[model samples]
Target: MISGRRQKKLGVRTLDIAKRLLDYGFHPPTIYFPLNVEECMMIEPTETESKETLDEFIEAMIQIAKEAEENPEIVQEAPHTTVVKRLDETKAARKPVLRYRKREAQKQ
Candidate 1:
């Protein structure tokens, strides 16, 4: 288990990295948990995982770090390849749109 803390100077949050992981064909790590640590990302790799898989994840992480430094905006607006794009999490949680409302016919 490896827990990484975000570097605020890098101008990227763990959530951004988590979303970006989808584009790299990986699931996002646990972020901002444990309460004590700020912007913590917890990664737990099982022994069942092969060396190649671990290497790929390492490479992906390195690449993401580089992207975070060079192109923070891209990292900030992530999950470009996912089925659904980034959402307003606060809005979704606060003002959820549960049902769809159809428009009535307008008068000509």
Candidate 2:
């Protein structure tokens, strides 16, 4: 269980870190809330993951931590390699878009 804490007034968002994990070919753990903990990352490794995979995940986390320390911006703005970037959670929650709507050109 990794709990991220804000340091020196620099905001460290657990959500951002989780999103960054996607860039590393790993799924982020469930974070924050429920436990009333701040920036909590609950890591539960399944038997399916091989030793190599676990090693890679550890490496990615170490790299992310380093980035957070040196260049916090990188960690702050994550998922740079994904097909879609960040989302507007507030807007999405307020106005949910469940289904996809194809463009007129695509309908042709």
Task: Give the per-residue lDDT digits (tens) of candidate 1, residues 14-84.
Answer: 88888888999988988878777777788887889899998999998889888988898888999999889
* RMSD of each candidate relative to the true structure: 6.5, 3.6
Per-residue lDDT of 89 in model 1: 99
CA lDDT, every prediction? Answer: 0.83, 0.83
The all-Cα superposition gives candidate 2 an RMSD in Å to the true structure of 3.6
Tens digits of lDDT, candidate 2, 1-108: 887775224675888789889999898888885477767889889999899999999999888888888888887888888999988889989998898899999999
Find the 10 residues in a row with the least total lDDT in model 2. Answer: 3-12
In candidate 2, the residue pairs with backbone N, CA or C atoms under 3 Å apart (3 or more residues apart, or in different chains) clash, namely none
**Stretches of model 2 off by over 4 angstroms after superposition:** 6-9, 100-108
